[model samples]
Target: MKYVIILGDGMADEPIEELGGKTPLEYARTPVMDDLAGRSEVGLACTIPQGMKPGSDTANLAVLGCNPRQYYTGRSPLEALSIGVDMKEGDIAIRTNLVTLSEEEEAYEDKRILDHSSDEISTEDAAVLLEAVRKELEEDAYHFYVGTSYRHLLIWSKGSVTELTPPHDVLGQRAGDHLPAEEKLRAMQKKSYEILSKHPINLERKAKGLNPANSCWFWGAGTRPSLPSFEGKYHKKGAMISAVDLLKGIAVGTGMANIHVEGANGGLHTNYEGKAQAAADALLKDGFDFVYVHVEAPDEMGHQGSVEKKVQAIEYLDERVICPIREALDKAKEPYRLLVLPDHPTPIRVRTHTSDPIPYLLYDSEKELRRIGAYNEREARISGILVEQGYELIRKLFEN
Candidate 1:
């Protein structure tokens, strides 16, 4: 039997007053999801382990049946794998985000972090900006590599993992309040601002009213990572389709194929239809038994705290991604088990990841289950089927 997982990253949310006291999933137009819920096993799964930080690194590991408490090294290490960074034993990998800082303040510390993703700046432009930083700051000990849009990597030789706050977590807050405790790391950040704030790119972006990627914010530090083979454990070759480096890195570590779709940027205007078609091709034509499709738009909109955009993102996932993949499988007369869920909740209210149990829908093509309400948080909760151990949910999908 073929298997598919459509992961809408950070799609879960709390009730928003602007959304008429309904979560985005509830408020959005998801007719395809609602139809699938009628014959699917709908429930909740706690993707984040207790006391663990509610980052996608931990949550996605749990969803893929790898216990985060055991396999998760850090977020950047996974992204490092995607970037093909051959990390050494004592080397450290840190996520270097091209973030936007308020330019009105003279002191670097006083500037607020205006945008974690610098308005989702193009990778081409970001690469140029990173090159400037690399020329001035990179040395024998520290090296820089550009990843996807706004996301980059920094490999520090013999560096220790330092406590650094994610820029997204403290949006609209003073940069100094959340700077890394390590003096060297903090100094690098200040230097990055000086280099980028007045760069030609920033001036051009300012002219166009775009958020200038004015500084580098480092976080998600870790050493090398080792993950068990996914095919060995599950006995099925799997593939991953995602725009983000973090998810691609997990695929690299687990020995799964990372299917890259052209134009698939991890933003609201990402290539959703391309991702759906890629997953269908991997399963139908490529002989892969399982495919994991991840969409990052909803989570990004949540981080921006836009209720309307978050709802629109969910609608796109339903109509653009989920509907096409399911139609292709059915047309091919394939007996498939499809699972749809989120890794964690980047609640619009909080604008950060939360360790909340997310709603899931498991649909079997050959069997029809008792009808459930719409595929959403409230209905999933009412179903009363809670998977306390999120890592085991994949087992249930494969074995059942």
Candidate 2:
């Protein structure tokens, strides 16, 4: 039987006053997911382990059946793998985000963090800006590699896993308060701001009323990780379809195929239909037994605190990604087991990931459940089926 997992990153959210006390998932028009829930095993899966920070790196790893407690190392190492950076033992990888800082008439310590993603800047522009930083920062021990827009990588040879704050976690807060405690890393961050703020690309962005990719905020550090192959674990060929380097990296390290959809990007305006087409092709035509599809829009919109946009993202996922893949699998006459869920909740109020169990729908096309249901978080709560170990949920999906 074929298997597929659809993950809407940070899709679960708390009820917002703007949403009339309903989470974005409940208010969104997710007809496809809602329909599937009626015939699926609706439940809650705790993707983030207890005492673990609620990050997509940990949650997605668990959802893929890799226990983050056992196999997780750090977020940046997985991303390094996706970007083809062969990390040596003791080598540290850090997530370097090209963030925007407020240009207020105040000291740098008083300046607020305006944006974590710089308005989801284009990768082409981001690459150029990163090149400028690379010229300044690259040393024998440190090298900057450009990943997707706003998301970049820094390899610090023999570097320690320094604790640093994720820029998104401190949005609209004074940058100085959250600066890294490590002296060298903190100094480098300041130097990055100095170099990036004067670059022509940022100047042009400023002239166009766009957020400048002004500073490189470093965080999400760790040594390399080791994950067993997906095929070895599940005994089924698997493919991952996502625009996020972190997900792609996890697939790479797990011996799964990373399917790159041409127009796919990790943002609200990314290519949803293309990602759906890629997953469908992997299952129907490419002979893969399992496929994982991840969408970033829901999480990104949540971070931006846009209730309307978050709802729109969910509707778009249901319409463009989920529906198209379902149609393809149906047309191909494939008997498939489908799982739909979120890694964690990036509530609109918090604008960051939370350690909350997300609702999931597991559907088997051949053996349909006759329970009436809707696919949102509240409905899953009503179902009363809970999987405490999120990694084990994949076993349930793959088991006959």
Candidate 1: which stretches are off by over 4 Å?
none
Q: Model 1's lDDT to the true fold? A: 0.95
Model 1: pairs clashing at backbone N, Cα or C within 3 Å: none
Q: How close is candidate 2 to the true structure, as a TM-score?
A: 0.99
Candidate 1: tens digits of C-alpha lDDT, residues 264-312:
9999999999999999999999999999999999999999999999999
lDDT of 2 by residue, 3-72 (tens): 9999999999998887788899999988899999999999999999999999999999999999999999
- Name the top lDDT candidate: 1
TM-score of each candidate?
0.99, 0.99
Q: What C-alpha lDDT do the candidate models reach, one value each?
A: 0.95, 0.92
Superposition-based RMSD of candidate 1 using all C-alpha atoms, in angstroms? 0.7
